[model samples]
Target chain A: MTSHPPAEGLKVHVLPAPFDPANVTLITQGAEALLYRTTFLAPSTPAALKVRPQKPWRHPTLDKRLTRQRILAEARVLVKCRKEGVPVPGVLGLDWEAGWVVMEWVEGWSVKEAVRGWEKREGARQSEQERGGYEIEGLLRRIGEAVGRLHKAGVVHGDLTTSNMMLRPLGSGGAGQAEESGAGSLEGEVVLIDFGLATQATQEEERAVDLYVLERAFGSTHPRSEGRFGVVLEAYGESYKGAKATLKRLEDVRMRGRKKNSKDYPPAVLLLTDLEGTVAPWPDECDSRTMHDREEKRRVPACLQPYQKAESYTGAGSNPYPPHAK
Target chain B: MENITLPHLLEHPLQVCLFRNVENATFLRQQLLDGNTKFEYAFLDASVLLSRKHVLAACFRAINDMLNDRLKSRNVHSEIVFSLSPNNNISESFRRFGITNESINVLAIKVGGDAAQIESHLTANVKGQPAVFSDEVLAEVCDLSRIKKIYRVDVGTKSDGEAARKEAEAFVLGSMALKGS
Candidate 1:
């Protein structure tokens, strides 16, 4: 599963009105955004809040525009899925201007962690030949069905990793026990999450790429069950009306390969540099003390001068959301 | 009177009273139109309400907006009525969800008011039999066809039952939360 260090200074950034900073727990800091667990509406009701911080490396206008657009797009897709009766988190609340989207927290472990945990326990108890059990196949089928429903709703999860899908425990408030004992049960409904890169597309190629991404994720993450990956496609074929056509397109997606250079830098790093400009002086080829004096002397590289001016302009001038802005 | 401290906004307790057959809705609506401070309660038409959760979701939205200083309506009480709407039209929301002369079953709500005072005021003003503000009572009073029409929910495919009601409620909450987005 994807993991990152606990956000050191995220509380300061996230603790606005309504949300208590102490109540916010950093769940994961992915490459794109930070996932925080916090309460919404009430303390008893949990929510997953995804915050996309400002990117200082990019032009501030472009950064603000992208953040607002992406959050709204994700929220729109989730609202669409919920309306279509697809199993996904409902959009509880969102602030595109502030760059946060709060979603109903699905209670369960990720499919990756669950399946791997199950495999480890089962392997310890049984023979290697019997490792690929019916439970594993059942879980794969559920994943396929969940993806099929998502595609049927005319949405494609651009990054379809096993980690993005959660297996929600059947009964309410049973997540703790389910994790302790039935962690490897392969039961419960599969609920999809993390729609950061999701888009509304019904194209066969897009659908194929979605499945292919999952296939690659399953193979890389759970090699013990790699042979049974076909079961996922098999069940997916029966999920919706045109699922079979999408599966046929998966072959072409596979042949063309999936590795394309995508923007992978975390926005936090970009934005942080904008604030401090600590890294800008690195290419000056000066010693630490001299660099400090040189920085004050306006000796910044000609290439870096424009970015320095943009950072200051964004810092003191631009307000992304005006007073009356929605 | 039911004093409900909705989940997040515990600071803003609500004084709610549901009536089965209100006779003075016209007077109550007139008081609101005149901006009388005494009639500051949200006088909602119960026919449009679906369940306790439905009412609570609207309350949550209004209170949340109040907290955020983003209320689109005149006050929290009117904001509560507006919150039930699936669209952004302010006056249209008041017309659809707010009390009118013809409204019989009424759901009276007052935010941050004394429960006893609000209850007694509602009882004296509204000539209606007091009813329990429960889902069962709401189910009986709710005009489902009118609700689906107002919200533009396509009920043609959904079979009539508790499941369908729950689905509709989910849609309503989603739409309310997404208002002005």
Candidate 2:
């Protein structure tokens, strides 16, 4: 007969022995580790503790290195960004030994949820065509504006999906959607979350690729995206130097690549946006076998080396979205 | 098993000089005899005494030297030693013994010998405990113990140096006694 354990104390290490199994709430469990909302007592604080799987399939040494690097890198990036006046969470504490990062827990729905909520509301209000355009477009434009500011501060949102933006309340009891844009401080702002892939960059191409990825995310997730996307570009243009020209060149290269090999260019609307001129042309124009070979060469004049070099400069090699490079 | 408080020991100079360090003993005696705090220069050799009585008599002789030669009445003694402990609870003990100012600097020297048994003892004691003591409590205990200096603590169990092991044991025992008292 097993005796019931006592209700655990306030502050508890998320390890063996004293850990109460009942108190562990699993948020998302991945191959690497499981994330749990754990409570600690002495001056009681609730923290999201991402614990590595006790028995990992990967090699232990490599996994440990990866864990150390990821935790350190995330903390370093956030601290640097915060110092630069970026709206990022303050690091509460860090224990490399435990591989746990304690950060300020944000309270708000993700942009995806917000968009879905608006879609549901519009669905109730009208028919499909009438429902599609205005409201969702407005939401995407706001996301774009947020992305523009991030780029202006030379911080790239490595993973710029709608899921990463939290649509928090406007602030101080007002129902209006006021935010912490480039004005006096507004408490309830639409903040970009998840700095897992974030890194500092000064290159235009790198910034362009970041915008490209977010544009694709907007198009794929929301309806009637083109005009809303233009609004985003408009804001980005206002924020980023020579942004419209760079975007135009990026679009031209994207079109040439599409005609040359349709297979390489997936039918994703935002695919053109993510092409940051990172792919370079052959040093000697060696491969002329492709269909739109001439057109491709004409669009990317300095080849893709300069652009790819720029990408490398911005710490894109370590990005997790396409893990092979790192 | 009770530890002596540092401040209390300082109140009686002759007793402290005899039991503490030979150098400290010599310095205090000279200061007492001189009846002054200002120093030009003074020197005394404590190791030359032929017997225990010779040392006590020498201490008295040194006191006269301080009074006649240096013109100082105040004596402050400073000494350094090394020890390893399972816990740093002496500071709390010092506070409890009423040594209000708790800022004492201690630097630890690592001893490769006598680590295993020390670690085993520490593991047995604090393997699963929390919120043990306040800094004030630790300082109070340290003051009460009269251990003005310490170093080379092996808080883990992997036994190594014979001499250092003994020293660490004495330090730990002294601290424990202070806690109990």
Candidates' C-alpha lDDT:
0.79, 0.43
DockQ, structure candidate 2: 0.02
Error of 1 at A58 (Å): 6.5
lDDT of 2 by residue, A26-139 (tens): 676655555666653212335455554333566888777777667666666655554444555544334343465544444556777766666556667656676644655555
Give the per-residue lDDT of model 2 (tens digit) for B1-181: 0111111112222321111112233333344246543321122211111122212222222232233342122221110110011133433322322112222221111111234443343234222221112222222223211322222233222233333332333333323212111
Q: What is the DockQ of each candidate?
A: 0.23, 0.02
Q: For model 1, how does the per-residue alpha-carbon lDDT over A77-99 read when each residue is reduced to its tens digit?
A: 88888889888888766667667
RMSD of 1: 14.7
Highest-DockQ candidate: 1
- Backbone clashes in candidate 2 total 56
How would you class the docking of model 2? incorrect
User: Which stretches in model 2 have alpha-carbon errors above 4 Å?
Assistant: A1-24, A30-33, A39-46, A52-55, A127-138, A172-188, A224-227, A240-326, B1-181
